[model samples]
Target: MTGPDRTPPPGDPARDGDAGAAGRFADFGPPRRVDGGLKARSTRGAIGVSWWSRRFLEVLESFALGTRLTRGRSYARKGQVLRLDVTPGRVEATVQGSRAEPYRVGIELPVFPAALWERVERDLAAQAFFSARLLAGDLPAELEEVFADAGAPLFPSGVAELTQRCSCPDFAVPCKHLAATFYLLAEAFDADPFQLLHWRGRGRAELLDRLRALRAGATDPAGATDPAGTPEPSGPDTGAPDAAFAGPTPDVEPVPAAGAARVLAGLPAIPLDEAVDRFWLPPVPLPDRPPTLATGPELLLRQLGAPAPAIGGPGLLERLRRAYRSFGRS
Candidate 1:
């Protein structure tokens, strides 16, 4: 069983105690390293590469863990962490410390309830851009805002939101060993941002499936809901025939059925040989000029935003705009 929350308040020197002192001392010495350890890819400077991972590390730093975090960073660099596993609501790891036996470490964050996730998934599915980016394995920076708007912050906002534990004899909430694990966790998140979602109680497959279902439902409301409970619409064939013609068409005149049939029967039947020369040509004369545009040619380019860097840089849009203007003038 886990012990009571002995985590001292932020900036409390008592929290560090003897463990804090040892952490500082360990900066000068090295802990027992492990073979085939999961070392951080970033050897120098910052640990996390992606923005999401950096945001996690930033949250950890804000906890005021002081020298212990520094020692953990050192431990991470030395590859002292033996193994790490991230699951829904928890991160478990084994770290090689000064002792012969490895220290067990765990960090827990509250998982969003199913109802909250439903809301989050709905919001995400509502936007095609967000769904497309996620499917392409790219986590947009704006996703954090999405979660925040849903009342479920994607990253832990404060230290209190995290429950940290280490089997090491450190009274400090996160001994150097735990700190090292945290750093590595950030790196892991950098590699696959879906790991962060997994830690928050939603696996990538499950989330993606739900997103797809929600999007499908949005497009077809008559379909049945998926297992995830997203509403899906039935086929268009189920709708009434009149529903297809529900919209108004003020300019169109409805042809009488008898008149239409007579018109079709009255058409002249020409021999294939006689019509061969004009088979591909229009029966009527073409317009004297092309149709005029209601908007400028550059309007499309403006709506599409900027082209990719490989296609054109910042000035490309301006040059294209000028070229489009010349087309109209000519």
Candidate 2:
């Protein structure tokens, strides 16, 4: 005699938990069409173009959601996600599923505390390379390492770090609707890694501003006042020469103190009244010819690598290369 029928009844949501039940789910059917939805830039293969975006997608795929991720990728490509908003500690989206009304999905991640971000900003500002690249709107590859060194990882370490929710009736933690949002979100990250940082509780402008302040403070420590709000005693007028030069010139190294003194001593001493007529003029005659232009106007592009996929990817680099060459010629 057959044991008591153990099969779950038809249309039972419990079936979603069974092995390979995702393939048999009726709601897994085609999602409703969406108009003017935020479609992923990548049509096939992987969704993310940048290393950081790929790292995020890699962490999500590691969860082994299996067919759910696949269906979500399909939804992303089909533009089934109507809206996606990423804010501090959270990502919210509206995804069109097989139902009449769209489903709301949200993915939450831990935000670094202000103290931790201050530490991170200090570390980032300490590294000139990091600060320069960030100011130039490029995410350096070592940026995540800097964040990790600050005791706060730049990306979610695992599934446990993320809290996912969906309005869909599917019993999965990340239903297809949420998965679709993930894929699109990866594309968004690829477009601007700052979005990932913004979701971590610090906006791009704020982070950059903090970095600038930290760098400036490091450069001019004497300008900083004491905790008691007392101004430090002024030093000798060593910077007078710099002030006389109308401020430091870009890419020009400052002269050593001894070297500057030697040069100053070598100068023919003359009365201020006698030198007034030629005081603004150069001590020596200027070079007759200007310096030759550096070759390879596209060198910066080569250093920066490919543009974001959302911004035309390789094609943009090629166009920029041509434009640079044209400008150089002109």
Candidate 3:
């Protein structure tokens, strides 16, 4: 096979044919019937959790029974043929070239959805979940029951409950064909924990529920009000000064006791824009404009008993004259 120079990585699945497995499962026997005596499936344990995909292994680890999935020496690397069958389940192929006889074989890996993993997300302000329980092999008891009830199963000490089968003619002592399938399924498990669960008819939904609870517990309690509360306007004394600036505006009239005409008598007919501009803009030094401040020399002198002209600054008129002089110069 020099076409592409393909060597099946130990435990790598060959989708189309068992020839790729190269006699890996030849010693393994045929797949057992679903209703076969418990001893059939009971005869074989699952590959180790570490042998499967990091993802599915993670979910398994999260379960209370994670360790139950690993069978023997974990066979960290074994060759296998994993394939989707023409019908329902997946198939495994093992080619035995050396032994009592040489033959090509295939077996189905179970892909079911026994327990649904619940959806979960970390509350940023709360816990970092993926690194916690899921990775630590601490699954809860509640979800374990759901998976057990399903015909699909989990290896008591391992991560995934995989199918064991092979096309070998030998008695079912884990002939190479089944071994290849087991190894292949283990490799597949390492690729994605969900794939094994899917075969076992399980999913992440249950894990998600646990995650929800985990995260919920870790989250900081919300304010006395909303956990994520919208801020509210507080008491008048405790609010912003502008927020407290209420009641009749200084600019608004008091309504003048109904019929009493509002006397615009002494007030100047000042434009609104000019008033707002004066209130908002930086003070302007105008050559001809009258003083904006109403308090004057006489009033200041009479109110404060000060000397006539001014204290520290130039006289108002002199300042006005100097401004006019500058304007003329410009």
TM-score of 1: 0.61
Better of 1 and 3 by lDDT: 1
Candidate lDDT values, in order: 0.73, 0.74, 0.36
CA deviation > 4 Å runs, candidate 1? 1-29, 221-330
* lDDT tens readout by residue for model 1, 1-330: 234334445455543343444332232234675778888788777789888888788677755555677778888988899999999999999999776788899999998999989877876776676789899988877677667766788888776788888876666767788889999999888889999999999999999999998776554434356899986544555555442245323332332222123224445778889999999875444323211214456755653556778978658988998999999899
Cα-based TM-score, every candidate: 0.61, 0.62, 0.28
Q: Which run of 10 residues does model 1 get worst, by summed lDDT?
A: 254-263
What clash pairs does model 1 have?
A: 220-233, 221-233, 222-233, 222-234, 223-232, 223-233, 223-234
The local lDDT score (0 to 100) that residue 87 gets in candidate 1 is 93
Give the Å shift of residue 76 in candidate 3: 9.0
RMSD to the true structure for each prediction, in A, is: 18.4, 15.6, 35.6
- Assess the local accuracy of residue 243 in candidate 2 as a C-alpha lDDT between 0 and 100: 31
Q: Which stretches of candidate 2 lie over 4 Å from their true place?
A: 1-28, 221-330
Question: Of the candidates numbered 2 and 3, which has the greater lDDT value?
Answer: 2
Where model 3 places Cα greater than 4 Å from the true spot, the runs are 1-88, 99-153, 156-164, 202-330
* lDDT rank order: 2, 1, 3
Model 2, 283: alpha-carbon shift in Å? 39
